[model samples]
Structures are given as structure tokens and as C-alpha cells.
Target: MAEKLTDSEGREDLVYIKTEDGSYRGWRVDLLIDNLSSKMEEKILLCSSCKGMLRDACFYEGDLKCGVCIPEGVAWQPVKMNREIVSDKMISCPVKKRGCEWSDTVSTVMHHLEKCEFFPVLCPLGCVCLDGERKGKVMKLERKLIPKHQRDSCPLRELVCEFCMNTVKGCEMNPHLEICEHFPLLCPNRCVIEGEEGTRQVKRRDVSVHLANECPLQKVECPYWIYGCREEMERKEMNLHEREFLHIHHRLSITDMKQKQIQMSKDNKLLEEKLDTATERIVLVEKNFESKSRELLTFKQNQIETSKQTIDKLEIATKKIAFLQNENESKIKELSKVKHMEDKLDTANIKIENLEKQISKKDSELKSIIEVLYSHISLATGQLEWKIKGVKQKIENKESSYGDPFYVGLYKCQGNIEWNYDNTGKVVVAICIVKGAYDDKLHWPIIYKYTFILLCHINSYYNYEITKQVTKEDLEKYPNSLKRPTEMRNDGLGTRSLISNTEILEAKYCKEDSITLLIKIELLPAL
Candidate 1:
């Protein structure tokens, strides 16, 4: 039917046709339809029950119905909504070389690339200048801005300092302002005014003047300076000095007041004008008072008349109030009933809360019991990690083998242990029995099997231990592990757990830039 109603005539190469074999076939639609179905009338199919527009309509039980409202055993074949294929070629993002992961049709590629995270964005700052390694230059457009990381706070952008008149990079601008000599700096003296600290902002260059000369703490001449008081002190100190010399200060104040009086006499005309102004205000106030008195008398007469009327109203209102009071009493009775219900509700709520707490407590107890059981089960499988962590902490804290050397022999035989790393960064722990360490108390040819354990401080599960079974004959024969000394001299207790440096560096055993490891030197139990 599409071919019968075909619009393409000259573009035969672009047209596609499907056969009974159903093999894959497609072509670019070189021509689009123009003025299709000109003679046909338009009719819209809607769902019978819901009134929704339906794509395909069919007759069901003698009534036209949509797919959604179709009766049982009724079906319809939908005419395909036709769309012209614009292009078969797919275009990848231009930033594919730079690492954008989008590939779509040419029409959609640009839209996807616009919002892609890896899409390259030029600085909105417009200037190509940069501060770091790319100094005064810009990289390729494909180099994407890290979205929020660089745009708002572009460190490479140039900024000028308001003070000192120097150009600085935005990254260094704050530090430059902090240390700029001409920058406005706050006074550090913290002058107190009415129990609050007062700060005066001044240029950093003038901070010394502000602190030493112009500050409130700076010394000043006394108020009685011309009166032969040779005291120069701080404002607070000058106040104290004036109090101590109150008699002299009073005499100076009296003379100052006499001088002020002389100055005041020259302003006699000004004082006369002020007196006239006060007299006019007095006359106005007296006139206002007379008017207010007349108004008050009339107000009192009206209040007496209103009070007589209010008495009659009050008697009638009293009866209504009594009726309202009775209604309020009835309401109070109902409120009491509600309060009783509320009390019952509160009691039920308290009981529910208690039961919830009890349920939560039982749940927690059950969970803890299950955990304990699991822990017991794990212990049977030789998971002694918890105990091992405690033991390792004791060794790391020097609490395990402090005063006495860790005994590594039968019958209180002692040995010293110290840690050191080899040239390859392998953690090498050297265990040795020093010369004459419990030698006088022991007989010659001492034989003891020693297991050197290096416990990982991170957790107790990782144990790097080596056990060496020593015979009286083998002790004299070996080079590293302890030897039966003839004169009770020193012997090295061999290295164990030769882990690679890369593994050791990243291992959880490394703590505080140094590895915390446990070394246990227990005298092997005798057979």
C-alpha cells in the first residue's frame, strides 16, 4: 500500500522494499511526501469508555472501540506512523579523541555533546592567559573545564591589589592582601570601651602611629595642665591622677568656670532671645492647660451620665452572664469527661511505649546472643583475632616486654628483642640473648625451640610467624638462630616474614608513618 501511494518517482535508488524472506533492507529516504491524501477526509478515533484518542480503531460487539476499550476476542492491526529516514550515517563527538564517550546520528550528536561531561569548554573569562605551567597560554578547546572546579575560582586569572598597586594572580591575591604593608589593618591593642573591646582599622603602614600615638591607651597631658600639674599619663591614668589631686583640680575647674562665665557674658543678646522664646512657650502651655481643664470637666459629666446607663446595662448583662456561666459549667463537665478519656489514652500510650521498649530490648538481647554464639563458633575455628589485637597492642605499647627481656627459654631463660629494617626496606626484627643473660642460673648446652611471631597491628588474623625447632647439636651448628654458647655470649634469633616493600608500605600494619608489629618470644613448651 505504501508503494501504491508512493511519493518517490526520480529517487528510485533510495527507495526500499521488503520481501517474504524478511531479510534486513533499508535505504535513505531521498524524497519526502508532499500533500499526502488530499482527497481523504480526516476522522479521529477515540476510546469509547475513556474518551482518549486512539491510534487504531476496530469494531467490537457492533460498536467501534479502541485497543484499551476493546471487548473480549476483538483485535486490530495498527497502521504504522510513518517517519522519513533523514540519514543512515552516525557521527561521533568531535571530542572523541579527548575522551567523550558519545556516538549518535549527526542530528543528535551535537545535542548529546553539548551536555556531555567530557565536552571541551573554553574559559568564560575570554582571555587565553593562564598562570601555571601553561603560563600566559591556553590549551586546546577539547580540554574540558572541570565544571565547577575552575570557572568560579579560576586561580590562573589575574587580579590587581587595591592596596600596594601590584598585580597578583587570583590564587595569591588573598595572601598578598594579608601581608601587604599598605593594606588596611586592624588595631591589635584591643582598647576597652564600656567593657567591650574596640578595634580601629588603619593602614598597615600607619599601625604603629595608631597604636602608639592616636590610640585611647596613648598618654595625654592632664586637664589641669596650665595649672602647674606636670603629669602626662594615659586617659585612664589621667582620670586617676585627677581624682588624687581633687583639690587642685577643683580650683582649676572653678577658674575654668569663671573663664567660661566671661565667655558667656559676651552672648547676653543670645541669652535674651532664648528667654523670650521660653516665655512664649510658657504662655502657650498655660492656654493649653486651661483648654484641657474645660475638656476634663465636660468629660467627667459625660462619664457620670454613661456610668448611670452602664449600671442598668450591667444588671441585665449580669443575668446573661449567669446563664453563660451555667453553660460554661456544662462545658467544663464535658471537658472533664474528655480529660478522663485523655488520661486513659495517655495510660495506653505509656503502656504501648513500655512494650515497644521491651520489644526493642529483647531484639537487641537476641542479636547480641546470636553474635556471642557466632563468636564462640569462630573461636573453635582458631579465629583468635580479638585476643591477638589486644596482645599486639600490649607489645606495641611496650607493656608486654618492658623491664625484663621476653623469656624465650625453659626455666626463666631470657632474650632481648629490638626492631630494625634492612637495606631493602624489609622489616627485620633481631632477637638475641645477650651475654650472661640468666647464664649463672642455667646449666650449659641450653636447648629451646623458639617461634618468632610478627603480629599485624591492623588485625589479629594476619600472623607472620616462623618456628625453629632447636636441638643441642643443631644450636652449635646454626649461624643465625640462637646457639648454645660456651661462655654465654650473644646470638641472633633469625629473621621471619620477608614481605615485599610495596606490600608493606600499603599494609594496614603501617601506623603513624611507622609499622606497629608484635613480636612474641615465648619459651617453647617442653616435650
Candidate 2:
């Protein structure tokens, strides 16, 4: 369907008819017209008959196709047209004046304005000049201004004076001159001398008057000034017409000597006071020495008395040892008897054991014979009775053989000879003396022999069997044992256990130069 209309001004309007078969035949009254003033290029209308591209065509049907493209023989109808305005300004570029042919919509034109090269650039110092020449000059002026401003504003600038080596600023020079030490001033006196005519300022106010009397250029009225009277003169020349002349320096020397004598008298009084103080200190030192000497003498007397008491105790101990030695001798004799009895008992026990073994062998043989003969007899009873009798006799023989009569007798006498003379004390000293004599002898064998004797005696007295054997290899492994006896004795004496039996046995001792009584005990093992 298509539609057509006319503007209010009534321009030419056309309405093409479209059939119900969807084809345009020709202009018909059924077509609706809309906006007849609108341009043909801006409006589209479909051909009812051919449905092809149409020019000079208005609304032909209700459809939006071209009028020429529609086919014929379709039923026709018309619809009112709706038109929309299109603006020319929407498709043109804003920079078209600068030869930019590009076109865009209004929204796209605003985005291009941000990055456009035609936008103005400003200087960093807030200057408006974008020209290169003026920008460089402005930057140079900023750099020069910074340092000049800093120097003028800094507070610690140095100031110095050109003369007199004193520091004065431009404002402080006036006050310094009034009190200046190096300032020159004219002399007040009108008197003139030979070489100091115009400038003879007095250095001391008190001595200025003396300079008038001692002026060297003063004229003398006698020959002392003209004919060389031979006087060292420094005095006012009086007009006296005389021949005598005297030296001025002689009088000044006499006055100076008298002042020095007055100063010496005051110094002498201070020296006398210092001498008295030194004498008092010397007297105090003497008194201190006397007190210290008396205290030293008392300390020495106490040390002597302590030494005497120690000597008396040592003497008493020596006498007690002598008594013990006498008692030890008697016990040694009894030990020899006990050793003899032990040997005899050991032999008897061996013989008795052999006899019991023989008796057991004979009993076994007899029982075997009886068993062979009693195969048919009721021999169990008779055999039991014989066996019982043999068992009883064997038990009686075992009791008799095992009985230790000698041991019982020895045990009874054991208490009486309990203090056996352990010649260990003497033996250890003798072995050490022998080792010292030979010098090269390894004394391990002597030590092992003594240990064996001690262990054997202990085992014998206690009736205990020693199962472990001490070998020569064991003695060699511990070779330091050779000197252990002497070390033990010294340690014992130092601990005040010199009379102990075990300590005496353990000590290693030596004789000194054929003197057996002066024994030397070694306190360390020989390496």
C-alpha cells in the first residue's frame, strides 16, 4: 500500500494505486497522499505492478518498496505517508575551512576537538607566547632571577675589614675608632729631641716627666757638649761654666739596686714559712716508721711460736711410729708359721681326694657283678640293702676327708697374729732404691710382685680362691704402676696418714746415697 499528501502550500501531489494482489497498476483514488512537498529522493515508494526502483514516485501502497518493481494485476489500496526531516548539518566536518574534507555527525565532531593540531599551546611559566623565540628568552630570564634573589635574601653573608685585621661592617666603623688601641696621637709636650723631634709620644703617663731631664739632645754649657768631656750623658744641660762632668746612668743604676733589695726581703719571709712546714712533715714520717717496725717484730714472734708447736707434734708422732715398728716385727714371725701350715694342709687334701676316687671305682665294679648274678633271684630287695650300706659308708668317708682340722686350728690362731709385719713399707722403698740405682730398670715387675703378694695373703687369710691370673702383658700395659708405691706414700704423708698400712704398702720410696734412713718417696707415676 502507499500514501501521499500535500503541504499547506499545495505543491504537486501524486498517489499511485496498489491492488490487493500487492501490485501497482496506475494512479488511483484509493491511494492516500502524504507530504506532497517532500523531495522524491528523500521519500521511497514501491511500484504496485513491477516492484522496481521508482523516480518521481510518491506513496503507492502501504509497503515501502519502489513503484516500478511491483507487478500488475494486484488488488490496490492506499495508506497515509509518514515523513521524517534529515538535516544537512549532521554530515559535515567542523574543520572543513582548513581543507579537511572529512564529515561526521554532531557527536563525532565534539570528540575530534580534544586532539586537534589547531588547538593552542601555552608556555609553562604562564606566558601566552607559543612562539619558540620568545619562550627561550623567558626561560633564561627566570634562571637569572633565582640566584640573585637567593643571595640578596640569605642572612649569613661574610663581611671583613681591609685594615688592622679586625672585622667591622659598613655600619660599625665609627664606634671602633674612639677606643682603637693602634690609633696614633700627637705628643702633649713641646720639648724637642734630636732624632724624635715631631713624634715622641710618651708610652707611660708616669714616666713622661723623666724624658725632659734625660733628653740626649739637650745642650751642655761646658766642654762636655762641645770638646768631648767623656761622660755618658742623659740629663737636662744647665748653663754652668765648669770643667767637671758626671755620668747620668750611674745615678739610675743605684736607684734600681735599692728597689731590688726591697723585693728580696719580702721573698725571704715566704721561704722561712715553707721550711717550717717541711720539717713538720719529716717528723710525722719518722713516727710512722717506728710504729710499723714494732708491729713487724710482734708478727715475727708469733710465727716462731707456731713453728715450735708444729715441731713438738712431729716429734711425738715419730716416737709413736717407733713403737708400732717394734710391734710389727713380732707379728712377722707368726706369719711365717701360718704360711708353713697352709702348705701342709694343701698336700693332705690332694691325697685324700685321690683315695675317695679309688673307693668309688671299686664300689661300682662290685654292684655290676651282683646285678649279673641275680637275674632269676628276687634280688631287688638285697640289691637295695647293699646299695644303702654303700651309700652310708661313702657319706662317712666324704665327711672324714672334707673335715679341715688344720684350717680350724689356723683360724683359732688367726686373731693372735692379726698384725702381721707387712714389710711392704720397707719393700717398696727398697725396690725404688734399686730402680734409682739402675736408672734404666722398668720397675713394673717389682710393683706386680708386691700386688701379687698382697692379693695372695688376703686370699689365704680369708680362705678365698683367686680365679683370675695377673699376666705380664697386663703389667706392661700399665707400666706407671712401677712408681705408684712411692707416689702413694708421699700422698699419705701429706694427708697425715703416714702410719696407715695400706698407704705404706702403696708408696714408692728410694734411699739417698747409701743412707737407708733418709727415704725419698715419689708422688707421681713414672712415664
Candidate 3:
């Protein structure tokens, strides 16, 4: 039977889907096997657990199970009959709806896809000339249409320049001709110079320079045009015109110079008359200056007598100012002493404010210390007892109970009572390593030994003491459990099955649904 497959769009039973290898796309199996064939007895194999189609890639022969379903430990095996059936079954082409009238077995379909005309392909030159988001992107055209795309629309398609006959890309042809030195161009003037017999073609880049200097037909003015000749001619004919009119141009230049000389003589006479008038004005100014000088001398003599009288009075006033300055200096010194005392008073106030801040900080630290003392009881030096309530209830509810984090010297830790932490059917006690305030000063990875004690409510002799030792080797082996904690706490290290549910009631370790845990930490020398 021929089965029909449809894509997401459900249009024409064919759509292009690109695979990683850029070869055959989606596998649409319209499998039709002959019932009379000997190999038709086999059926498709599937995973027993996931029910996924199984292939050779997932077949695990060592444990007789599918690799994809191995986590569930489901036993399955690939059947030889399934591979035989697949290799012999006839499947229609992937692009059958795209006018590809081809069909083959699964074994030869991969090879047939390479030559299929209806198979979709990408532009081979997209990476070379396409820009931005289109770089290296797929073209999604049939295999037969690739040639037309490359020839018509591809920017990298090679083209021959009509002017220079040079090879260039289609997109770059226009810009190339703009700067192409060998490109041919017609002369604007269309001049015909003697002894040169060729098309009046000029290169695009050199057109301006040729018109200015090399083009014989370019319009130019005569050399004597400034002297009223007013003649324009082609560049090639300029020499002949200049030779023929040499005598006439020289005559015109001589007559102009003679006229200029006559005008200069009249200008010289006018300047001499102006100089005589200026000399007469200077004589009148000197006479007035002498008269003013005599008057100024009389006024200066009178001012000198008046200055002497004013100087005597100023000398007497200067002596009185000197006495007043001495009195002002003494008053300034006294004012400075008062200002200095005021400055000392301000300095004392600043010191008093600073002392008050220090006292407040000390008081906060003392309050925290008092809280720590009330939170837990201490049996001896370096030994702390944390009272954890609701221990029995937490065990019955299968919940873990933890005491508040406390510091033992430089190390911070918490006491935990976990129910069946390791599936041991018993209550376990653990100590968590918390990030401490003094971790920076302490040696790391931390090296220490701690004694965890489960105190008996009835007698001290029945108490359970478990010692956990941490060394450099232990930190290296289990760094996450024993290293300097980077977060709030590290994984807990403790004893498993400190007391079973039955044994806990018999031993009387728990009292009134509460338990007391004592921890003694000992610091070791750093290695």
C-alpha cells in the first residue's frame, strides 16, 4: 500500500526541511512490501518501555536492551528479520508530490536523493556575496533550478564588461567602470587632430585630464587675448594663429605702454603739490606747540610750592597712624586667642560624638553576646549543648529538625536531627558547617575534630558520643562536605542510626518530645 504523508502546511504532501548533513530531508515512508516475498514475514521493532521505533543506532547487544530505554532496565533486542524487511520494502520518493516519479528500497533511497531533481537545495555562492542575515542562508529551491539562480539572480555571477571586456561580478560592474582606467569614452569636443587616425575614445578616469592638456580639439583662448585680441581656437591650431599675428600683438602692446607713461607723469605733478601743502601745515603746528610749552612751565612751578606745604601736614599725620596701628595689633592678638579657644571647643565636641558612636557599637556587640549565651548552654570550655525541641514529633512526621546556627570559636555550625537520612530505619544526628564571620582568618580547608553527643535523659552513662575527624586528606577527598563553606552551609557530616525508633524509646534519649545535643570541637595544626 502507498501511504501519503503531509507536512505542517498540509500542502501537496511535500515541503522542504533542511537536515544537518544538507542531504535528504524528512523520511516519509510509503512502504509497500510484497506479501509473496520470503522476507515479508518480519515486522517493525519498537522499544518495550517507551514504545519508540528502534533502529541499529539504539540497539544494545551486551544486555539485550534498547539503549534509549536502558534507564528503566527494560530488556529488548533488535530482530534480524526487521532489518531484512526494511532493506527489501519499496518506499516512494520523498519529493514524489513535487513531480519526482521515483521509488526505491530504503537501502538505495539515500543515494537516489543525491540525483533527485525535485529535492530542495541551497545556493552554493550565498556565503560569497550575500550580506547581513542572508549570509550562508539556504535558498530553498529545487535541484534543477540552481543553475538558473546562479546565472540570473546571484550577485557573484561573472559578467564581461561591454566597454573594457574585463571580467567582473554583476553587482560590481557599474562601480568597476566608474574607476576602470581602460574604459572607453567619447570626447565631448569631437576634435580631429592631424596625424592621428583613430576613434575619439577616452578613458573614463582620464577624461578631465585629457580635455585640459591632451585633447587637440578643446577650446582655448589666444595667448594675446588679454591685450584685446579676443580670439578662441582649437588647441591644435593655436600655434599657427599665434605666429601669424605676432607683429600686430607687439604693436598693440607698445601703444598701450606709451599711454600708461603719459598718465604717470600727470600723477607725479599732483603728488608734488600735495607735499607743499603738508609742509605749510607742519610750520603752523610747531608755532602753537612752543606757546603751550611756556604756559605748562609756569603751572608746574606753582604746583611744586603747593606740594611742599601738603608734605609737612602728611608727615605729622603719618606719626599718629603708626601709634594707632600698634594699638590695633594688640586687639587683633586678643581676638585670635578667643577664636583659638572656640576651635578647641569644637574639636572636643567632635571627639565626644566619635566616643558615643564607639560606645553604641560596643553595646550592640554585647547584646548579641548575651543572646548567644541564652540560646545554648555550655558544659565546659569549647563544649556547647543545643536544646532542640519537637525532635520526637519531627521523627514521627519524617521531617528534619535543626538548631539555630552557632559559633564554636572560629567555626560556625548547626545541629541537625534527621529521620532515616540514609534509609537505615533510625534517627541520625548531623553537624552542618556554616559560613562563619571569621572564616577568612581561619586556615582552610578546615582541619578539626568534633564530638557529637546525644545525651541520655535517664543517665550520663547511656549518652552516645560520635567523633568525626576532618584532615587535609579528608578535605581533598570530600571537599564539598569539609571545605570552607562558600554558601550558608556545606553538606552535613554525622553518624547514621544514632537511635532507632524502637531503641530511642527504650534508651530514654528523648524526653518530652525534645533532645539535647552537645558538641565539642578541637582545632588541629594546619599542614
lDDT winner: 3
Candidate 3 scores a C-alpha RMSD against the true structure in Å of 22.9
TM-score of each: 0.23, 0.16, 0.42
lDDT (10s digit) by residue, model 3, range 50-81: 33222321345442223444555455445565
Q: Which portions of model 3 show Cα errors greater than 4 Å? A: 1-88, 91-104, 107-120, 126-153, 157-169, 175-182, 191-196, 262-310, 321-527
Number of the top-ranking candidate, with TM-score as the measure: 3
Candidates 1 and 2: which is better by lDDT? Answer: 1
Cα TM-score of candidate 3: 0.42
How many clashes would you count in candidate 3?
Answer: 0
Give the residue spans of candidate 1 off by over 4 A.
Answer: 1-94, 97-99, 105-115, 127-129, 138-151, 155-185, 193-216, 247-527
Off by over 4 Å in 2: 1-268, 311-527
* lDDT rank order: 3, 1, 2
Rate residue 71 of model 3 by lDDT. 52
- Deviation in Å, model 2, residue 261 alpha carbon: 8.1
C-alpha lDDT values of all predictions? 0.53, 0.38, 0.68
**lDDT tens digits, residues 30-56, model 2?**
222232334463344334444432322
lDDT of 1: 0.53
